[model samples]
Target: MAHYARRRCRSACAGKEVSLMKKVHVIGGGLAGPEAALQAAAAGCEVTLYEMRPHRSTEAHQTSDFAELVCSNSLKSESENTAPWLLKQEMRRAGSFLLKEADATAVPAGHALAVDRVEFSRRVAEAIAANPRITVVREEVISLDESGDHITVLATGPLTSPALAAELQRLTGSDQLAFYDSIAPIVDASSIDMEKVYFAARWDKGTADYINCPFTKEEYDTFLDALLTSEKVELKEWEKGQYFEACLPIDELARRGRDTLRFGPMKPAGLTNPKTGRWPYACVQLRQENLRADSYNLVGFQNHIKYGDQAKVLRLIPGLENAKFLRYGQIHRNTYINSPAVLNGTLQLKAHPSIVIAGQLSGVEGYTESIAGGLLGGRFAALLARGEEPVAPPRQSAHGSLLHYITHAEAKHFQPANITFDLLVPLEEELRKKIRDKKERHRLQCERALEAWGAWLAQSALPVG
Candidate 1:
């Protein structure tokens, strides 16, 4: 750790005039941007937060609220010793503003850290409004200010405006990588047929928070056939690319094989049918979407099929035969830069430390991962504003490993990733061979990560929560 810090000291531009500024300009008001503004403010840097919304909206967003969560309400698992949990733990230790809002507005979705997105966004907006150090600007940033005295953090996320994207491409002299991200449909709660579906969480771990749609083998076959024949929303020539496998549209998944949906999102492994007293042939889980509990989204059911075809195919599931959809599954262009070719370990441009790139734009995926990027990027910006060398988190921590993966991955094959045990620094060979239990190995990794994270936070030159 000391060696890495010393290495950083040798190249850091602490004495340069650019690092002496007290101002920070953050573009975008999505999950990562607002968090960056708050963290920079907390570190005593004056922040100008820009959000071009309502007046200039994107394809997927519906509201102008800061930190609006569009894709899904669930923020992944909260089960202890899991990768997501480890990341959130580190964020809590650092006093992340968005995470706090998520906690306050949480609604039941079994063991996952789900929230009422509307309430959560409102709370974050309130925090930004009340903070004296943050000045909100409602407008688009179409061009880069290369000569500004203040440092800039670009966090425009997946749907970055075309002009800003072009400016970034021009600045870096590299074409930003792009992907297709799909979102699932939200169903009206009252329209679901209670008689056909049952309420249960997988393995009956605790309170039943999800509504499970069970299927017999015949039913599953019928649905798959309809899905295979459905009309889909075709991608334009420029917008075409294979989607991230993790978020593949259901029909795209079905094309893999007849049984693909049976094991993928529609898998029935742990969910037991109360009426039959056995597991169904297949199942589709519905997660709560908000605090009101009046709506639920099809879990892992993201699709790009035409809206009418989507309704027809999805309704073939037993309980959804008469279900009313509040929102149909849709796909959007998800844009991001190739981090290894563009960003440093501190998530700043290699040639320009004054410019930091975070959020989905920085190539980290998922809700928590985006916030983690913002948290770290904001702190680094704060350090630079104070004319200090910005330090990267210890590699053992979730924050460190995630940043490391994105910044160190091979440029040609780099893809945005969620926090997973595979991304973390592994245990020594001897330790791995000695402990064969997968769960125990994971626990040890989590323990080691948190300890290192704590030491780094305490020992940083300028500490940030």
Candidate 2:
């Protein structure tokens, strides 16, 4: 069996030599961690993938499955020429194991890549189990001290265990290491009022993949009042902190001002109500939950309010008046390190080069962003094991932009980031002036990034497959 597995791995790597492989310890079996392990294994490193589930559990996860998505099923936009699309495209080109699994388990979600959570997790577990160079261990990793000689990739994600988190605090010498993130609610598809809500993607970009609940001025005001007066879940003393700006709960955003939500998530721009034949005062969009179309998630409707009050407030939306919620919005602690103070662009800790961090814990936000980190960290760990220098993708690329932001952003003001064009290096001044359209500029940037990424992949010691 061992010999056959080695032959399979060697065949996958195009018959590359696997003699004298070094051990790679990956802490956590979430999206980034497993991707790192797979990439390392593909690069000829022996990997032990650790997951502390079933034996132990966290607030967000409900299952023991590897790479179980705790929040939304969507992996964000798949629209071409966009930053998220570009990042996923690069990962697919580089043979990201998780992305391949995602594609295999994908559900119809307009232009966004959504998946059946259960199937996705199952496939990830199956793939990890079948890999010869990767070993799965269902045990809690409580300390970085355990990884003495082997290369360690910390992809434990935002819901890292307390013991491991404490150890990390001790290692990094920083106490402010955690933040809060929220999850949106999901509703049964049969509960939506088809007459009240119209199906359409924003700006007609993709297939009419979203169910928009258009609101009149009076309905918007009533809903806002309910949201403001809704009973909220009290935060524990230790869980208190400013919420990450990117994942702010609905109530938190409402606290800023009455019009804040109208301008933010609930904005009606680019969406016209079929009944009224004009833009409504505001709208709440519901995205498909799974391939079966049994449920839909309230896009950008995350809140920390009590479930009862949440139901009451949410039902005030135009089409959700009869909505049967499959899951209520909840908030959880999302712990992440201050990466700029500790991590290099290659995702290695400055104080300890052997220790690499990836995923949400590494301070990059969004699903695709976490996978990108893991891919890089795993590849770098494999290269280091082979005594080769790890090369980062070009700064012009989305991968490099995300790495640069995490490692070089102002430490005092450091926060997690989702992939955005702003993070990538701006186009040349001459070109920018010549091409004044923002979309056109982004197109050029994507073109340049793909070119650089291909060149980097060719030169790097990591395996392309």
Across residues 243-315, which tens digit of lDDT does each residue of candidate 2 receive? 8888889999998999999999999998977777899899999988787888998988888899999999999
Query: All predictions: root-mean-square deviation over Cα?
Result: 4.7, 4.7
Q: Compute each candidate's TM-score over C-alphas.
A: 0.94, 0.94
Model 1 stretches with alpha carbons more than 4 Å out: 1-20, 461-465
Candidate 1 matches the true fold with a TM-score of: 0.94
Which portions of model 2 show Cα errors greater than 4 Å? 1-19, 146-148
What lDDT score goes with residue 62 in model 1?
Answer: 87
Instruction: Give Cα distance to truth, residue 34, candidate 1, Å.
Output: 0.6
Q: Candidate 2 — which pairs collide? A: none
Report, for every candidate in turn, its global Cα lDDT versus the true structure: 0.88, 0.88
